[model samples]
Target chain A: MSLTRRELLKFSSIAAVALAATGCSLTEPTSENPESMGSVGMGTPAELAETDAPKVVIVGGGWSGLSIAKYTKKFAPNAEVILVEQRTEFMSCPLSNLWVVDAIKLEFLMHDYLQASRENNYTFFNATVVGVDKTQKIISTSDGDIAYDYLVLAPGIDYDYSEWTSDPVLERRLRTEYPAGFKPGSEHISLRNKVLDFEEGNFILTVPSGNYRCLPAPYERACLIADYFKKEGIEGKVILLDENPNITIKQDGFRSAFEKLYGDYIEYLPGSKIINFDLDNKKVETEFGEIIEFADAAFYPKVRGSKLLEIAGVAKDSRFNKMEADINVFTYEVNGYPEIYCTGDARPMGFSKSGNTANTEGVYVAKQIAAKINGKKEMPAWESPLTICFSAVAMEPILAISINAGYAYDEKQKAFGFTDVYANEKWDGRVGKNNGKGLMEWAKGMYRDMFNA
Target chain B: MKRRSFLKVVSATGMMIAINPSMINQVLRADDGRLYKSYARVQLLNAEGTPMTEQMLETSENYVFNYPYEGTTTLLINLPNESAKDVSLKDEFGEAYLWKGGVGSRRTIVAYSGICPHQLTHINKKDSFITYRKKGERFEGHVVCDGHTSVYDPEHGCKVMKGKAPQPMASIVLEVGDDNTLYAVGVLGPDKYHEFFKSFRRELKEQFGSKRNAKKEVVSTAVAMRLSAYTQEVIQL
Candidate 1:
């Protein structure tokens, strides 16, 4: 845990004055007033535990960052690793859909960052990164500046509601009121409340174009909400608005659930893009000239890498997403900056942006960073990140569909594509129950892998 | 790996005996488990309290036994053919070690830590994602963990044949006594016992009643039984 901003500012200023009085270069940070460092935020050194070991600073405490921190420390024990995250606690995004519908408790989605740090022997600094000094190898946070020998930026994803609406007021209203709930924390809570307190009329959800975070999540959310409505005997329906022509993933299973299970509760619309939104009237105009009305909606827009990549000067437009990290595909290092690495949802790769993908990819990234730390000349060979995702189609018994796949670089396409794809699209009878059990087990295993159980 | 009718599935969980931690701590402590160290030469007993010998083994079944530590479950398998010899393997941390194949008259018996070395997916009391697949199965003649689909070949010292397992499963060095009693002596390759204990502390508390009870080192003998009998739900993928 970190001190409040006010306390830190005062403490840092006092320390700076004390250092100035002594007139010796005692610390790595300059003896300047932290308030004077405008864009830099905090000029004072972070009040971290003193260590002479090589510092490996990681930004974000999500699945990717957490895994990298733990595995990097495990593989290279001598390195002093620190994970800088803005959030106080970690909330899992994978099984959070279950949490949204009251199928699973909030405790299941939440994890203590301090516990993860304590068990893994890394420092979890609760601070938001304000800026980075590439030349000095220092990342300035709201708390203070932390210098590092190696830096890993794993800021996940940011919602791009630009294409939906250019009006800032409309966008702001969308963000605060009817949020996409892709990111963890408040958005998820808001979404959960919106579903639980919902009484009647159509509850609209959208499937955004491009390789969005958790390809099947929107479909799963629709199904779960429809199931909730069906179970509660609520006079409502879920109008699923998909930009794509058909179901992007686990089509058979989701279609079956929509038809066989929640026929009256769900209205799945394919290739229906919201060209115009009438939030005032609770209606939206689709691209194919279909005007849809709703009582409530969660507009999940197109996803792009976090704006942190642009701030770090490592951003570029990828084939799939805009403003993603421009890095060597094999190694996660920034184009020319070997010491700086960018991973997780910010990467330009076409890998599925799910918790499982991030965790597996994080391990591979950790290996590359560890190799450099261990004084290895050559980085390890490129490894494929396994994407194992499970989507719930029902709630009472929790019938689900699953996908287990790995990626391989395709020379012809000059890009990466899913290989060894295994899909279990059966969500009926005992097989569905088994898949449901597998889903829970997979999640627990993933949680244990990322955190220290 | 389909669910079979478990007719003779025995429950011998009453045989759990806690040993002195201080005494076993000396032998259990290893840097990377690179050094082959011996423990209690416990006899492998089947469901009927009869010592398991060569004739009583099934080639297609997955057997379970706790070793070194109570929470650290291990897999005992009798392959259909003679196991390969002197298979070279590497640990997750890039340390290389040799696995000196299987034991018994037909050289078909092999044992490995049930816990996956990659993510520590193990044979848990509730459900086991890791188990042996029978002949003509998806991962035929291999121990497949459905969690991440990590397939380990018992014929080649449980070497990872597919999926994302960082290292091969740690081999349980077994020996046949003069009286033909099978005993697990030591472990070869890198073991995740320490990490396993550290990772599953919460589950350990629930499963064994306390962390200390779960961490209790195996001293005299460990009950060997079928995987289906050990875990309540043995999931198949």
Candidate 2:
């Protein structure tokens, strides 16, 4: 629909408020014309009994997997939706930076998947997916091989430990002794305890270069740890070593905070790539041949798609093995295999590999699948999804700075592009404090929408 | 004809059928009124209670005032007479375009939100907000963020001229009173500061009732002047 610039501004304001109020509920009315919504009644129980119905299987229970699982059923009720995830409990990595500094309890990040499965009316199997037989249309799980008419892979991300060393002993040590804490579990707890135990010494933090989940997080962790040190009156420095020359995203906001607020506490060293670590000496060597000693360290390793992508033969490279999806940007369908879809951090997309973006993509893909099932020729391209990130600069009064942007699909480029209007806008201090509070509300609303709805 | 009027006619006849009726109503309603609500109006006055004249502003290239509410500040630009031209600039939201050089026409006067859009650092003595200087031969003005050296061109719609700022600084909507006193009526960009002041004023009114003694003790002379100025601007608008 054509709208004047004035109308567009007003509409966007209303849309922003609506999105804030209702987390990720972007479903169009499906009750009126089920066929118009998508191909439906193709996966009914009676048809399943007759072996004519289609069974859609979604792997992983992370942000993307859970969202699509719920939305697939909502959009196409007749489809037999089954979610196969290894983990029973859902732990969010989005706001876990708050947990690192003891600002928020670890329990706040954990949620049960049982409620989400029951509410969405999808079969949840808490079993590891060992293999996928594309020819047989079956997923080999630890329990048994489950058949599927369609398969969606949203297996999150895994660290690329290839660069560190091939020694299994060293790999085991790196996993246990120096945890990345990117994944949510025991490692996160260990990292938190390490920060609490740290006292009056140089605590080094290394950030890897290239594509990783949550680009702004390492900088955020630095700020949070600095704030923690300052609060506890610990005469220590957070020496942040980055592979990139500077802060990748929201450069102005983070750089200003580093200089003005945490300059004395945080020794930011950019373009200092960690070549190797001397675990015995508690030292790290950069590419420039500078050996820095530290009391403790949290080395965030570079990430790639899970091993499942490589095993499934979808990944192109071994270093950063991300699945290449021959996707119709509007439909989110893989060109060759209409029944297979790849999304989240595992999929190679132009968009940032973020939880928010993943969640939005999950919804989009699910709707497209439903549309295809209901005999719809084509689905409309989604309005650019908004990704809102709040970076906490201080913890006492809870001051944070926010960077929000909306992405639109570029048909010519076949990629998602950010518009100048809503991109790179920020608010800090009291306004940011309010935004930090809003993050909690947003998380609550997001959980409720996904599970309770 | 006014843009709003033309839009109303076009929306009624052509676009109404294609668009949702509720959306049309919303658009019409928004267009009929000012986009932003006036939070506080501060009167531009010297220590002596006289209205600020064009002559007083001409002496200085830029005048900085500490807005009474929430310690937020406003930077007033006094354009050179010969160089002064009618400049129309769109706000950050692009909802409305604010026009400079009208009404009294003594000088092309404009105001900008003094807080840095990058980190929200308010202008102060230690870190001056805007510095006007001559670069070689031509005069140039820059809104300098003391926290970081993010510079914004004051004359060119407060656009980021240099440094790492993401967006332009917010524009403060000002009105020239009959007595030539500058009054801050509204702001067109980020209104978080305005919202804070509104809440702060509410808290003050709750603590101190209609008692003049409480009001006198609580409100500063600058704040009082602003409140009076805002009321006058509201009436004039």
Candidate 3:
């Protein structure tokens, strides 16, 4: 008898659990809900015995991954969606930045991704994906090798010290001792303590070589730290060591406010590339002819996709090791291989590697796969993503919002051009007395949209 | 400096009209040619001159007006002695700058602008107006900026006392209406009083002095910037 997607999900869940006890795999056929999943609860599990739905495998229960999983279930409730995440609780990276600053505690950042999976009637695997076989359309995790027709990857970023060429070992030593505090938890708290007791000296901040997760974050950190110092009446200068020639986005406005008000307190040293550092001396040697001693320094190392991307042969580019896909259209399939799909930060796109972008890509790719499986004539095209960033200078906060949409083909230039709609502005703290308030709201809303929507 | 100006004639006539020291009444009878007419009748109540009395106050559902002095023209309202509760009053600048939230030997609703003279931040009564009385120093009423912790002296025409706000707080005239209600009659300072004066309003761009590059505004910026820098430094420890 033909089983509907909902019935299949229910039966497969029982079968999945039973198989788990016996350590076996019950390879089942694909299933999906026939009615559009715009609204929730169209038919009961008993009536869902005759629908065909696609099977989706989502790796990472992060903002992007969980968001895709939840959206896929919402758009096609009968579809068999399985989320493979290593963490039982998903922590937000957006707000995690504050954890390093002691602005907020960790418990406030943690959310139960496992509970969400169960409520959505989707399968959850609390295991890490070691490999993805593109040819076989199967993912080999610590738990078991799971097969899937459609795959969405939002497995975030990782740091690399190799780019610091002149002094990789020294930089690594600093990290070993000081910790990056990029991810939440112990590192965040340790760093937060270091900032609280900071006294008279030169505090240095280094920007990463490539596209980091959040662009305006380091600058925001500087501003917050500067505000902290002014309040304590400790005399010092904050020296920003930029690997790049100039600051991007709110850097100009930040410089204006910092210089006009706190210029005496801050010494901006441009063209300072972290070629190497002497951890023993606590001195950093930059590309420029300057060796500086720092009381405190935060090095935002270069970032790239997860190592799993390289192992799966899903990543086409070696430099960043990201999947090369036609971003104009949502197609994650390898050349001539239509069954397998890739999405999220792993996929190479024109937009910056951001959590928001990854989440958008995940939903877009998931819908495409669902459409192919359901034989829907039209599918939503890959639209450009929107970005909202909040930066706080001193006590006042500013916000910038930008959206990218539309595409263009340059025939003469033999290149593709895109038309996009974008909007951005610095937060006028006058409107809202509190800094970072809107940012907190956006972070919460974005997280909910990704996982709960 | 018109010799026929109402203020000039009033000074020459030697009339001892006791105006609220904190208030700037621009209703000079000498300036009849001044393009604007008074919108409402104001009662001047000087807390410094006359002790607050219950008989001098008019209580309404929305507001309570204090008439300290009996005059054909009233422009100031004094607070009642027994009334110890916080009373908030919005200045002519549409900024609510005063709230009597602190307990003191005596409390008065001195006429002060809600706008921070240093920057345009609204002077919030809750955060502003708390001055720790120094030894041998008078406890000048303070006004705090909600945007920044800039404080101003309410008694000294809203001068910056201990904060980043550079300009002195402007004052407005308080008047009792026909219904015994208190209203903001006019503002102090030639620039402030002329801000809404029809023809003069068109000329006035912003009340904050543009040419005066005073160092008074640095108190807030300096403190905040120093604290932020210190936090960045200590966190490394």
- Model 2 lDDT tens row, A1-453: 112334333433553365457553222213432211111111111111223456788988888899899888988888878888888788888778888888886667888789888877888887777655454455556654566778898887888776666777877788889888888888788888889998878888777876777888888888889989988899889999988898877787778778877888899999998777778888888889999999987777778877676555455442234444435445555555667787777766556667667766787788777877776877745644446566677776666666555567677966566753222223354455555554554464356446652
Between candidates 2 and 3, which one is better according to DockQ? 2
DockQ of each: 0.48, 0.03, 0.01
lDDT of 3: 0.49
Worst 10 residues of 3 chain A by lDDT: A34-43
Query: Which residue pairs overlap in candidate 1's backbone?
Result: none
Output the better candidate (1/3) by lDDT. Answer: 1
Compare candidates 2 and 3 on lDDT and give the better one. Answer: 2
Query: Candidate 1 vs. truth: CA RMSD?
Result: 8.3
Supply every candidate's count of residue pairs whose N, Cα or C atoms clash at under 3 angstroms.
0, 8, 58
Which residue runs does candidate 3 get wrong by more than 4 Å? A1-53, A166-174, A234-236, A318-330, A334-336, A395-435, A451-453, B1-237
lDDT of 2 by residue, B36-122 (tens): 233345566653566665556652255666552445556666654322333444333233433333223654566676666643444
What is model 2's native contact fraction? 0.00
Residue A148 CA error for candidate 2 (Å)? 0.9
Task: Give me the displacement of residue B156 in model 3, in angstroms.
Answer: 56
Fnat: each model in turn: 0.52, 0.00, 0.00
Per-candidate iRMS values, in order, are: 1.2, 15.9, 16.7
For DockQ, candidate 1 versus 2, the one ahead is 1
Q: Rate residue A148 of model 3 by lDDT.
A: 66
For candidate 2, report its TM-score. Answer: 0.58
Per prediction, the TM-score for chain B is 0.84, 0.56, 0.35
